[model samples]
Target: MMDVEVIENSNKCARCNYCRVCPIYTVEGWESASPRGKLYTIKSLVNGEIDVDARVVKELFKCTTCGSCEVICQVEIPLINLWENFRAHLNSKGYILPVHKKLREKTFREWNPYGESREKRADWFKDLKNLTSTNSDLLYFAGCTASYRTLSIARDTVELFNKTGLDFNYAGVDEYCCGSPFLRTGQRDLAQKLFLKNYKKWKEMGIRRIVTSCAGCYRTIAKDYPKIAEKLDYDFDFEVLHTVQILDEIVDEIDFEDVDVKATYHDPCHLGRHMGVYEEPRRVIEKMGIELIEMEKNRENAFCCGAGGGVKSQFKELALAIGELRVKEALNTNADYLISCCPFCKLHISQSLNNFDKNINVLDIVEVVIRTLNK
Candidate 1:
């Protein structure tokens, strides 16, 4: 059974519809697309008031789980976790979405969410041996996307690490997905399995601290894993740090060449709101000596890239719509480039910009750092 407390607390939403004003659903303009609608549907299912149908299940899977609704809710409903629990319950009832099911299966078998071979996981570090040292206290956890699709980010991050004189080691194939995807999509059992595998590996390697570039991975490792660990009687005693946080700590030691580029940042929901890490990334950007332009909505109130909550895989159109809105917000700043700390945000926003034929450039903060270092 799902957590009783979560069910009780979530049911207190009272259908106030305060959360319907979120930019995501406002842009989509659908009632079933809103968080309250999904919550009521899930509550009905739990109360046996309505049978679980494919249409109802599809609505539940569409949400990015960005928690914008929870942020604005007067009743303080844990909508994100509540939706996740409902997804898990639906999966247990054999109602898995096809794409998500395939992704989960591949992640379970291949150790990466993309379902690719693990042998190529370390390909991003090719010819970059000088960038990392063998003995370093800092461990860079390059999530699957950066390792494969966004190899440039992985390369730039390592270059910045070397430029900053930070000792770093990366676990290549030995590293597995941090299980953020699984957790967000309601495959908690699989997420727990992945966490156990990763925690054991990190423990055996004597890793005292961890840093991640992916906001989802950062939140999962730093926040979710601890609770999972408690249930399994496993103690994970390590500092889970975001790369931006680490970069902020050493911002003073580095110097950047003057770059006259206007840039705006998109706050990845997991990193900015969920983890409360808004300042460090901004600090790093300012330290780079670039003009930091703020979107009308930023920090805790910033919009989501629409890639979270398994929406990218389940509802591609809606995810792209959310990403397009974010891209437009950055473009409104008239910034030459848009910067985000999360690789997933970078990927989604980049696609949206291309699709919309907008000229705004999308980049990771590490990419900006590496560029400034070279300049």
Candidate 2:
């Protein structure tokens, strides 16, 4: 018995185009870019209707894999999984994009998608209290983006834990890629290798729980990790959580001072649609006593930051183009700041904010905690 949701929906697709929800399609507007078109193309390929080519690979990889298409899909397709499955399928047929090929090599070689030195992974902690060990029950898995790219979020997250009297540990440089970048890009073989390595590390250290400020990390380790682990004949028993989920637990204990800006929250597609973590970040924001305005799309209906699915790395311009739309939605709220729980979202949307000449600040929930931590 196969998982029907996983196996049959692609063929069940009614070609209704109800899944016009694709972000890439929203920007590219090509029939090949839309989910409906992808399904047709995919169906044809499976039935020997067409030949695989560089062009098809390019269109298939155009997606952000945001799961929006999955939400509105008329046939209840497990669209995210479908896209990824097809991506892996494409890879099997030697359709690997150069960018994806480079990313896979860089991640495997450098232990991160950034191609940054593994030693510098802990550089963010040099200025702060760096906690790295498995002695503590909680391990802060900063993921590559937060640990290297968005250093402030990593620092501020530790600061928030301090302010709220939450005790945890950080993996620092010992942290490897969560394999999200590879997984999203259809490099499941590499993803599985990294996943097994990290799981073995946590198991050896007796880590009881893991928390992360990166939504991609949260989804990968919390949800995808266990799934992949079972495939590896390995079991990862540690509890996984997002920093916001931990903050939500200690939210009332921590004090917050309101700043001058009205803030709107952006839900990371991985955290919101991928994992269904809609309210914890919201609750953390509301508890700050700041004026929280809703974005045009919020919760389950939230738009993708265009940074997921390896889009930011491969299609930089397109990623920014899609991100600009989300930034526009945030700006329309007249909010001075755009807040999100995921560092990847922070990195992408923050770039868009600057690109649009909008003076709006992009903040992670941890930074907000640092601001109001009885200072």
Candidate 3:
């Protein structure tokens, strides 16, 4: 059965074409790839006007779910949630993509979508000094990407926290994936299991505040978890935050050496449009005395890094294409570095730059901040 809310929301597309601002639609150019086209297709499927086929499956899963369409939609439709719910519906009907199927299997079996060992989840920080025990008011969740794919982000974040004298804790091997991958890829059941696992662990540890270096984890825990908590009748008592929010609170207090550089900030979609975190990262960068340049599209209008919503894993070529466009925007500013708060964004944007013979440095804001302090 089709979701009633999905049906109602699909019926709400105004056909204003404002959602052409969608990054994927701009690249794919097929009307079927457009936000409106997806909505119409969804409505037809929901109303039994059409049947699911290969073309329908491909078009539906093509979106990165960046929430750009939601930002531009004149009818105020919540396109991001709509797409996820529609995908969930599809998943229930066994229409899961092959890569997404592997993603689900890995996440459920290994506690992360990357199929990485849970034991090595904390290996990124193994070499860092002054590690804390599992007990503290604060927890540093180095989501799957930072712990495995972007080791420097996790290390730099820990180093910054140590340098700044912030009392925090690390979950070590016990730190499960925050389930952003599951949520974005329509594995709500898997998401719930991970959420419950993390939530129970936090509660048992008496954790009052949680900080994550990854934007996807921050959004999943801060924004998505409470909804799950309410549904499951869990207490959900912890305060969740991204590292930039913590940096923003403390940036004014930190004294830094002079590091002259021109940089541009890329707002991760989970950090920016999905969660309204636009200025804190920029403010932190500017506070460091770096000349912060703005991209042609920024803040709520920032283009996606194309790594989210399972696109990079499932549709590699399309993801890189979208990512290349964002890298071009960063390069157009002629900046020395491209900065972002999300490790996933940093990882994808770095890979995207490899497509060009000329490349720029891509660092997480936390990495830049740590370097400035160490200098």
Candidate 4:
């Protein structure tokens, strides 16, 4: 049975097509691709007008859940939550997407989402002798991508943290997926389980504050955790912060060497819009003494990199295409680097740049900050 909250909230949409006009669907140009269509289908299922078949399920899965529709919705409906509830409902009924199901299995079996062992999580930080302290109040939750795929980010973040004289510690093998992917994909039960595990571990470790380089993890930990804690009665005493926020706070303490580069920033969906963190990253960029060019569509109106909401895993080509569009936006700025605070955004946009014959550089905000810091 669908939760009463889900049923009532999902039915609240008045079928207005404001969400349909999103740039993503506009660029893709399909009715089924619009948020209104997805919501309508979900509403029909709740009203017993349609069955939860593979086709219906696929329609729900198509969304990146970028929350663009929610921002433009006249009724202020929680479109992403509705989609997540629909996903959870579908999953409960034995209708799970093959890609998401496989990824979930891997996440459950191996603490990391990439089916890698947990011990290797901190292997990337092996050479950082400056990161030896565990008693520091600052805890760096490198997320899955920085921990595994973009190990350089992990190293650079540590180097920057030390260079700025901030005592930082990592969750190391104890860090798991931030449950953002699972939550975004409608695996709420799995997300809750991972949340409880991570929350409890962090609490016990006496971590008073947490920071993550991944926008997805930042959103989940900073925003979603409090909600989950209320539901699960888990008491969280720590403050969750993004690396950009921390770096911005400490920007005055560091002086940048003259490194001339024109850069544009890509606002990760979760970090910028979902979490209202638009200024801190831009502040970091401006403070770096670099030429910060704005993308035509930036801030809340920014386009998604398409890898969000498990789209990268399920619809690789679509994700890449969306990423390519974002790359073009950066290239249009004539920027040397596309500085994004999210690791996943960096990964997708960097891949798009490489694959699409673009010379634009993609960088994480920490990398940029670290490079600017006196070595």
Q: Number of the top candidate by lDDT?
A: 3
Q: Model 2: per-residue lDDT, tens digit, 275-298?
A: 999988788877887788999898
Q: Model 3, stretches more than 4 Å misplaced?
A: 130-134
**2 or 3, greater by TM-score:** 3
- As a whole number from 0 to 100, the lDDT of residue 337 in candidate 2 is 73
The digit string of per-residue lDDT tens for model 4 on 1-375 reads 886777787667777787864645766777777887776776787788988778777767887878888888888877777777777777788888889989999999977668888878878877677466467767889899998898888888888877777887777788888899888888888888889888777776778999899999988998888888889887767788988888888888888888888899999999877889899988888888889999988999898888888888988888888888888888999998899998899888888887666598788988887777766
Residue pairs clashing in model 3 are none
List model 3 lDDT by residue over 239-309, tens digit each: 88999999999998898988889999999999899899998988999999999999999999999888899
Residue 158 in model 1: lDDT: 85
Model 3: how far residue 114 lies from native, Å: 0.6
lDDT at 297, model 4? 86
Per residue, candidate 1 scores C-alpha lDDT tens digits across 331-367 of 8999987999999899888888876665987999988
Best by TM-score: 3
Off by more than 4 A, model 1:
none
- TM-score, predicted candidate 1 vs. hidden true structure: 0.96
Single out the weakest 10-residue window by summed lDDT for candidate 4. 20-29
Instruction: Please list all clashing residue pairs in model 4, or write none if there are none.
Output: none
Q: List the lowest-lDDT window of 10 residues for candidate 2.
A: 1-10
Cα-based lDDT at residue 145, candidate 2: 88
